[model samples]
Target: MSTPLLSLRGLLKRFGETVALDRLDLDVPSGEFLALLGGSGSGKSTLLRMVAGFEAPDAGQVLFDGRDLAGVPPHARPLNMMFQSYALFPHLTVSGNVAYGLRREGVPRAERDRRVAGALAMVGLEGFDRRLPHRLSGGQRQRVALARALVKRPRLLLLDEPLGALDAGLRERTGFELRALQRETGAAFIMVTHDQGEALALADRVAVLEQGRLVQLGPPRAVYERPATRFVASFLGGANVLEGQPDGAGGLDCPTLGGTLRPAGPLPPATTACALRPERIALRPGASGTNTAAGIIEEVAFRGDDSLLLVRMPGGAVLRVGHAEEDGAPPPRGSTVQLAWEAAAVVPLLG
Candidate 1:
């Protein structure tokens, strides 16, 4: 691959007695949209701030274009950050706010005006240049902030919960817009978001963090479909993790699910858990496979496109299942059904 436009090597950060980050390393290729995904206090914001020069790592290096960024002031970095607040100047009009960065950089007046206009146009805010931040809608304000950040033509753009301020509908809509804008501009973007759907939908690659440590990093599909650990599978949603130990006959003896799960391939002797996505499981009328178990639908939640089923297995384990709406009305609550999944769908996870 081409040289990474940005690299964080062995990065470490701490606050008092808490370790905010622990020897984390990541590489961002040019124009790749990477999302740092984690729950609150997972060091995602700390990592983003470190890259933006707002915070310093206790150890290791933050490199951009192969140059160390140690001691680089926030304003001196060749990157721009858009915060959750949008941070557009309420006193300045859209164009003025966008032009502020260029003016700070001491660009010529004509160049600043041209770039401001182009940036506003890029974000679909061409006609709102004279509107103040308070006069614009939340989405518009967000666009203005984006315009300001892009106006400087930064090599890397950092977004911290960029869509967090918008309503659910708008947040989902803008997520696609942001992804499109990133692709159109070809500027590498590193977004920090707690929303799993946002990260999975917007990012080309996702870095999953847990307790200040890098837990998993990969393409969205890979990370979601083949999570490396129980935390990842649970955090990303729709995973039923069961305590299991290798049965020695190429199957995992899962007492909770009351079955022996035979994954597609051989598992390590130490493997003690198996994770299966809810959507990967199918509810059938009768048991037919080694990976099948009988369960009663204890609860059902209709989620528009799909219905979520809480299946209580005979062993008293509640396994969440995502049954497609098209499969007909979900089995009524209290109805006993067979839950089956292919052996290949079972992912053996090590503790």
Candidate 2:
């Protein structure tokens, strides 16, 4: 295989009592869009900061094109990091702001103008060059920030919560625009985000973090559809964990779980606990099966397209099920209901 454009080898970082990153290793392919996804304390932002040179790793190496980036200052690296705050100059006009980096780099004024204008056009803010940061809408200001970052034409772009400040609608739109821009420029873009939906929508692959460690890394669909462990399933949501007896072949035989559930992934031999996501579970409702469980509806939450049903099983485990139909209106809350699913849908997890 060709060498990754960027690689992190055994990278480690710590901030006083907290271990921000723990021997993290990752490789970014050329022109790929990667999302560093995690909760508030998961260390996604910290990792991004380190990658951007704002913070240095305590150990390990950061590689660009197989060359070490050790000791290189932020500006010397072939990268640009767009801060979460945009960090736009309040006093500079849109064009002036976008041209800031170019001017600093000592590019000729005409060439700087051309590159800045091109970058602005790419972000759909070509005509807003005369407007100051205060005069621009939130989205427009963000586009200008993007233009400034892009004008430099770095081989790699790091985004720390790029859409965190925008409104919901604008955030959605900007996600698409960013993806399109990545493809057009063929630059490797790594984004840090706490929003699962944003990661799902934009990333070619996602790296989910926990306490500074990468729990899983894969395409968005693979990470969501086939998580690596109990931690990943639970973090990504929709998983209904069940304690079971391993049946040797990635299958779990649980008396109350009502089926012979096979591991959708490689289940370690000692695993006694398993999880089946709500969406993967196909109910054989009211049908008799080994995988069928007797449950009482505890709560039913109505979402427009799907409903969340909490079912208390005979074994005392509460199973969260998601479905478009409420299973006969969620069995009238507290009524006994039968829940069944396929063996393949069971995603086995650690004990």
Candidate 3:
């Protein structure tokens, strides 16, 4: 296989006694979109800063292509970073902001202008060249930041919470646009985001970090569907984690559900827990079958596109079941219903 476009090997960072990154290692292939996902203090931003040459590691290496970036300055590196704040100069016009980097690098006026125009057009900002940052919408400012980063034509781009500043509606729209832009530019992107939905929606692969350690790394679907650990299953999509004892016959005796669940797939050795997604469950009026449990509806939450039903089982465990609005009105609260699911829907957790 060809070498990865970027590689972090045994990276370690610390501030005072708190460890920021604990010998974490990762790789980003050429033109791949990778998201670094974690909550606050997960070392995601620190890792990004290390790659951009803004921070030095106490141990290990940050390799771009194949060369180490130990002593290189941020601007001297061949990659650019788009900050979460957009960080456009309030005084500079859109074109001016995009051309600042080129001017600093001493590119000729004619070449700089051509590159600036191309970058602007690439981000769909053709006629807004003269508009100041204050005059543009939040999304427009984000595009200007992206264009500025792209103007240099770097092989890799680092995005630090690229959509954190946008409203919910705008963030969703811009995410797709950003993905399309990444494809068009064919540049490897490593984005640091705390938003799980954004990571799953935008990244080709996700690296989940916890307390400065790399917890799990995989494609979004694989990570969401078959999480490697209990933390990953609970963190990514908030899967219902049921703790139980292994029955030795490829089944689990779960006290929470008051039953034994037999998964279609073979269980990992010493498995003590399993994850079931809320959407994987079906609620029936009256049902009695395998992999089924009766519960009373504790609450019904009406989301815009769908509803979430909280069911209290006989064993006192509350399970969330996602119900689509298109299926007509959901059953009222206080009603006893049977929650059924296929054996294949249960995913065994490592811890």
Which is the leading candidate under lDDT?
3
Candidate 1 at 81: error in angstroms?
Answer: 0.5
With a 3 Å backbone cut-off (N, CA, C), the pairs that clash in candidate 3 are none
> Which segments of model 2 are wrong by more than 4 Å?
247-250, 253-268, 325-330
Ranking by TM-score: 1, 3, 2
Q: What are the models' TM-scores?
A: 0.97, 0.93, 0.97
- For residues 1-351, write the lDDT of model 1, one tens digit per residue: 667999999999999999999999999999999999887899999999999999999999999999999999999999999999988778999899999989987999998889998998888887998888889998999999998899888889999989988999999988998999999889999999989899999899999999899999999999998889898988897588888778888898888787888898998679988888889989888678688888889999999999999999866779999989889999799998988888889998865
- What C-alpha lDDT do the candidate models reach, one value each? 0.90, 0.84, 0.91
* Candidate 2 lDDT tens digits, 74-96: 88889999988999999999999
lDDT of 2 at 302: 84
Better of 1 and 3 by lDDT: 3
Model 3: lDDT equals 0.91
Could you tell me the TM-score of candidate 1? Answer: 0.97
